[model samples]
Target: MNIVRKLALSASMVALCCTAASAANLTVGFSQIGSESGWRAAETSVTKQEAEKRGVTLKFADAQQKQENQIKALRGFIAQGVDAILVAPVVATGWEEVLKEAKEAKIPVVLLDRGVDAPQDLYLTSVASDQVKEGRVAGEWLAKTVGSKDCRVVELQGTVGSTPAINRKKGFEEAIASSKNISIVRSQTGDFTRSKGKEVMEGFLKAENGGKNICAMYAHNDDMAVGAIQAIKDAGLKPGTDILVVSIDAVPDIFAAMMKGEANATVELTPNMAGPAFDALDAYLKSGKQPAKFIITESKLYTPADDPKGEYERRKGLGY
Candidate 1:
């Protein structure tokens, strides 16, 4: 071959390889709903790890419990032209416009741990635990324990507009509706934070008659439940005995509380949603296939009698 022809061929091959590499280096932008709970932090950790393992470039944005921040981050990701986007929405509403924009850009969006109210076709898939079932599990456990005993419950809800808070509350209420003995006397948002939970629980403790009318406490997450335990202690009440406590999210602290008999029951919301979300992303991106509208994860209920010490030890090692 002539030297000039050889040089031209080599240059053409180099350009083609560069183009292929650029196409293969999928850039996925992820907007997390801040590290509010142990479960949320663990989800973030696993997501980053998963992206690294798959050799995909990840651009992360922490919304810090603000909806405006998430909107801004979504816009930034759109401007940057990410191949795909993953959002753990801070709340369920006010996502229509941003999602529409992403869809117009032809970037697939995957929801993690929460579902959006937008049209399902706008987002590629949602990978989340069934909040309704989780709430029902807690309610069933409580009902079985209480039986026909009269129960006045104080509810510590999650963030107001969040899916977990809304769906969990609905499911729990539905499950306990037929049981006349189980009634929610007081309910308020704890914002899914420990401090908020403690503060709200304190108010509940100070309610008329020294919270004597309250028989149990229910929190949306384990952090809040643990906080409620502290409040119960400060109020000079026996947590597990005098006032039963139940919550969702089987975090390490909840396990510890269970071991100490300070908490009664919890429903596990595993933080491993990121791994399956990424798998869905990989499949869709590689094959041009559309994934399911929702991928529901299975969860379980935990109690003190369910190997309390082992549960505590195992959760402690989970880097919660």
Candidate 2:
């Protein structure tokens, strides 16, 4: 080959090689919302597994359930020039500025399992379960289980002002709105924690005549339901029998509770939010295809008849 032709070909090959390497070395930063619950822990583990499967570099930061920590982590990711970012925001608002910075840096941001109140153009997409549907499913189960009987329900809600808390409560209320026989007699925020759930349930028990007047307990998440189960037992009441227990987020512990006849039903909030977020990111990065603004995950309901032991075994090893 002529020297000029050979040089041109070699340069082209080097450019191709560099492009391929860059494509293979895609780096993403993930800001997790701390290990506040078993479901959150499972999300972190699943996100890492998904990143590894895609051969992507994942830079993970735990926000410790603080918005400031999340903001700091996002800024760091932007400064590092990550190809993309995944954030399970601790709260819904106050994310516009940081997301704008990421947009200015030309880094795509995908919300995981939660969303922020930012402009649509600022984020690639949000991957989360239909939290309202989750709550509705739980409420429906309770309504069906009661079957026209007058049922007074006590609710253990998640963190106040959070998206999940708000939407889940809305969904449950919608579900039971037409059921004149069922009513939420008492509701309190459990902060999505087992300890807080227990404490809140204790107060409800005291306020509701030692749990006798409560026919059912509906928790926004399973962690709270599990905690409430202990509170029910402490109050010398049978949980699943005396007070039907229903909740969202079918974590393994809830399944265990179901197995022990402590919990009646639970709706699943799958922790594989990152899997869809990564899929959307890959499509956007590879072909410039825009995913839908919201990618809703499954909201499956489980009861004791669904073989809680099998579900527990399936999820027990997923770092939950």
Top candidate on lDDT is 2
Q: Which whole-number lDDT from 0 to 100 does residue 122 have in model 1?
A: 84
- lDDT (C-alpha, whole model) for all candidates: 0.84, 0.88
**Model 2 C-alpha lDDT per residue in residues 1-320, reported as the tens digit of each score:** 33235334534544554455645667788899899777789999989889878877777778789998888888877876879999999999999999999999999999987778888999999998888888888888877889999999999999999878999999999999989999999999999999999999999999999999999999988889999999999999999999999998889999999999999999988888989998899999989999999999989989999999999998998888
Q: Would you give me the overall lDDT of model 2?
A: 0.88
Q: Write the per-residue lDDT of candidate 1 for residues 12-62, one digit (tens) a residue.
A: 544554464555667788888988766678788778778767766777778
The TM-score of predicted model 1 comes to 0.73
